[model samples]
Target: MSSPVKVYVYDLSKGLAGQVSLQLTGKQIDGVWHTSVVAFGKEIFYGPGICETEPGRSHHGSPLRIVDMGETHMDEQTFVEYLSQIKEHYTADKYHLLDFNCNSFTNDCLGFLTGGSLPPYIKDLPSDFLSTPFGAALRPTIDAMFRGRASTGVLTPPPDISATADSSNPASASSLLQAVAAGATSNNSEMPSSSRNYLPTPAPTSPPTPVQSNSLTTPVHIATNPSSFHNVLHTHRAVVAFFTSATCGPCRMIEPVFEDLAKSKSRANDVAFVKIDLGVGMSNAVGGEYGVRVTPTFILFLDGNKTHEMKGINAPELRTQVDLLLYQAFPPHRHTTLSLPAIEAIPLNAILSSQVPNLDIVLAKVTGFIDAAPSWSGSTTKEATKQILAKNIIPYLKARGSSSPPNTSFEPWKDATISLVTNLSAGELFPVADMWRVALLEPAVCSWSATKFGPGSPILVLLSKAEGAPRNYSLTFLRMISNAFANKIVARELLLSSRSSITALMVAALFHDDATVRLAAANLAFNMTMHLQRLRVEKVRGNVEGDDVGENEEWDIEMTSALLEVIEREKANEEIVHRLTASLALSIRLSPSIEQLASLLEVLQAQKILKDKLERGGCGDTGVVKKEARKLIEEVAEKLCS
Candidate 1:
């Protein structure tokens, strides 16, 4: 059952009704009114007043009306706390006439307590009256007179029970209402003789219990002997042992509270609450073991190790300690629910159509070193730059050997394009990394992948005219860039800061129908995942990025999903198996949900891709993929599930 609410309305301007009509409203009116909320059984009255200490004194001598704003979910303590918050914010010094007056206060309390607002006729009265021209004209006089009175006398309420009532534990509703009525009928000119002497002793209480372990409902294990005590300690991960004596008065008072808490369903499985009465023939040696020098002592254990001990008849503290220990033993799993930004594709066609430089001449000049360039090697700056601009790089073919440039020529821009990409991969130039990504990379890849190869553009010329060689080179180029990002923090930072567009491009390529393209994209995705995993772990260890580049763990989940999608689609592609396995293995750090875990395991098992390779002791490369896959399988089985 819930407590009921009431609204007390008072006509503050009744005495000056005639003076207000002649000065402002220009017509006879009932009276100016104020309202307050009193929740039945809550033992508190909430009202707003100018420069006032408590409720009754501000609305003194005013005609009163009470309105019922039915049942509330708040209890007596919660209700009192709610009033404390209101009083803290609506102190007399901060009171206002037009903006935040008493009526506004009542409305706030009513809305919270009952989910309903005061009647419009009463709530809108001040604002509607102030909007009138005559009322507006008299605003200064009204403000001056009211504020002067509020600061001097109107805001000064006499000593009410609220002043004496405990802010944490309010007086009973019957007592508060009696105070309200007494304050209302008494003369406002003088303080009541008995008002200051009405302080009531608050009932003893405690804060609400923290969430307990559900297994608390099970019968407590009795440690009648040393062997039984040892067994119980070894069995339970967290044990709350109560050391009480039969003759201790405080222990008697708290025994029921302890028993009731032990019977609650919220207690954890590995945590136990037990009472051992030393007066009931328990040995002194047992008490000495726990260092129990006084009656009503508690000792907590974690994995048979003594962790914390408490003395006295404090049930709340005991329950609190148990909750803390349980939390440490089995912390709640917290996976973020925030959504990742959608991966947007780059517009390649639009970029190609715009100002394209003559790359034919540029490529010719740069390719002069092709013969002298060493074979494509590692990520060394000299080798990578040398290979990218080598002369063997296919030139953008002109129309039918007509030696005429097309209307839209990206072929002439190939040298400059390769140069920019190479520099980006080498971690040389990347101003506004996200801008370069959103503006250049995303649109270019999206447009190029969607369009067919043709003479109209340089890159398209290779994709269309050349056989498998051109496509292979393009895929390899993309893979190299991905690898660079995987190895270099600078490159990774730029790509990630680019609003995940770079990731989007890689994900898009992963779905390519061509096996070579898919393999390259898979490698890139694997590298990106590894890089992100490192950054995430570093962050958890308190390594802050100097640039304050915010990390969104949700993006990792999104990328993981994309990778999983690829795995499911291309499970039979052995060429990508090693990369996919390694990627999935490292990605396990993201803490995927149970449903995701089920899907991932089902895919691995049904395909027999990971299990078979691990059993045969053969996984491509240094057996890293196999090792990671085995580890991931075990981890998923252990942590993500039961």
Candidate 2:
């Protein structure tokens, strides 16, 4: 470009760097010169005199002069305003300031300002003067935005760039309206459609030409709220947020709880359960940003940022975490794979109330699809729909609930089925602790038995262990309850002891012909060693503490004595088949003075599975260990007395 007209002026920093500052300060040349002046749009330039090069600079660092659109000197007010804008807004991580090097922007900005050129490494730059050392103008905003943060750190407030551009630049509206009305200018005649209405007419005297500014981008903010959030985390001192959603069943289940919590003066005051509408705030862009595939994601926020995010509603467990969180003044909301808490690692109650963590947030996922199939021959689409209907979990549940089958019929997955039947005897299922724990601790059920007579899918849902049970009857038999919630049994009470109240339950648990029922009972026997040891310890402990050692109480010492007395009392013809219990009693007596654990170990050593079981229990490997121990302890105690 030819050297326009040489003009000297003070460099003013404003508008995206030195951008538009010159336009604001410069006066337009009217009449003949209007096209020339406005053609460059309204120019804004700021920076220093680069007429002199530093130690070793090239053409990119060529010397530059100054100019004021109307005068030879800058106005003090304009100068100050320009300085303030850049200090507050200008930022770039590439500008990390080093001790040896200058500040993040200084050296390069000065190079651009004086050279009237860019640094060889710099790409198309923002207002060149924004970084200039002219008055350290951008410092204040820079400090405020960064504020004691790491040099590489960045978290900026929402921008107003787009808004400002729409208001000030006429081209923004004209282009938008034109695009909106493309191929159909038919509507423009009706409405002026004014984006230009926001801006004050910038001195009508200026001509039709537009100013060029590829460097500046007005600040802008995203327009919508979020939909489903996987883990919208946050922290707070008090009840800071609420998590509610449009489709949460448990969120529905516990709506009463949240309301109750809200009503309780202390708890309500302590914390608030916020509702999050995942359905409304969902879109592919934001959905993918935060893993929010499920409804009713509760995200706790203390101030403005996130503290905790959860989906679904398990009242008991949520109460546990929220209660603790309030006491400790921390965030305890957690994410889980499903709505259910990890029944194994954590309390089953909490997982139930916890939100379901889903990263896939598409409607297609919720209403899953199947490929066109030959079996679905009728109008293929309708057939697919029928297939899906048949496969739905809801219908299966409804069908199971309608008949109300006997516990014996569902004995294969008895542990889980009982839990579901008991906990959710009503319409819904809330895996509460008392119920959830027992289901997990129950032994393996018979898979074949369940498959044959069990309400397959429905039983599986209520009794998570049902699927893990063995379904063998003829020759093949399987046993391994590897499912999650099977530990609740050990965590709760049982019906095996001579309490007449559980006699019916024992009959059902033991004699049921279904293989699932039998397998579950066998599974219960795995806790044999621990039961026997605990009984022995209780006997010794009661002797030392002089505590009430009643026959009815469920403890090691008491149960052992009771079992033996019962054996002698009944004097039945049946003989015990599982005999290691006798050997264990002798081992314990041979060394009563030894550590209580030593006696237990001797009995365990007598059986390989028992030893392996004890080893596993020591490492916290399985729920069966406790049950196994309980059984073994009882057996040994009975044998000693015999």
Give the best candidate by lDDT. Answer: 1
> Where does candidate 1 stray beyond 4 Å?
1-508, 511-520, 527-576, 589-592, 603-607, 612-642
Candidate 2: how large is its RMSD?
29.1
What are the lDDT figures for the candidates, one per model?
0.44, 0.28
Candidate 2 lDDT tens digits, 1-642: 211212221111111222222222111111100000100112222111111112112111111332222221323343234324233222222111111011112222222122221221111111122222221233243334333223423323312323323223234323422221221111112213221111111121111111111121111111112311211122113542344444456667766666455333122112334343333222233444555666544444443445566667766765665555554553221211123211112111211111221212211322232222222232224333433333432233223334552233233233333333333222222222222222332222222122222243332333343323233211011122222213222211222222232222222333445544433333333233233333333333322111111223223332233223322321111121122233234223322333443444344332333233234342144412344443554444333222
TM-score of 1: 0.28
Q: At residue 246, give the lDDT of candidate 1.
A: 54
Backbone clash tally (model 2): 85
State the lDDT of candidate 1 residue by residue for 1-642, as single tens digits: 598877666654333432333222322334455565666532232222212223344424323666877888867665555445334444333343443445555555665566666664564344334433443543454345335534553322222323432221123312322332343321212333322211121111211110010000122433322333554565567777878765799998887777655544123235566555554322344677777889888888888898998888777897788777767764542422322111001111111112223445544434443323444333334444444433322232222134553334333234434444333322222211211122223222323322212233223322222122334444544443453443232343344434365566567777778887777777666665556555444433322221122446566457656765675466445557556645654455434343565465565452343344444333443332444445553333343322
Error of 2 at 508 (Å): 4.7
lDDT of 1 at 557: 58
TM-score of each: 0.28, 0.18
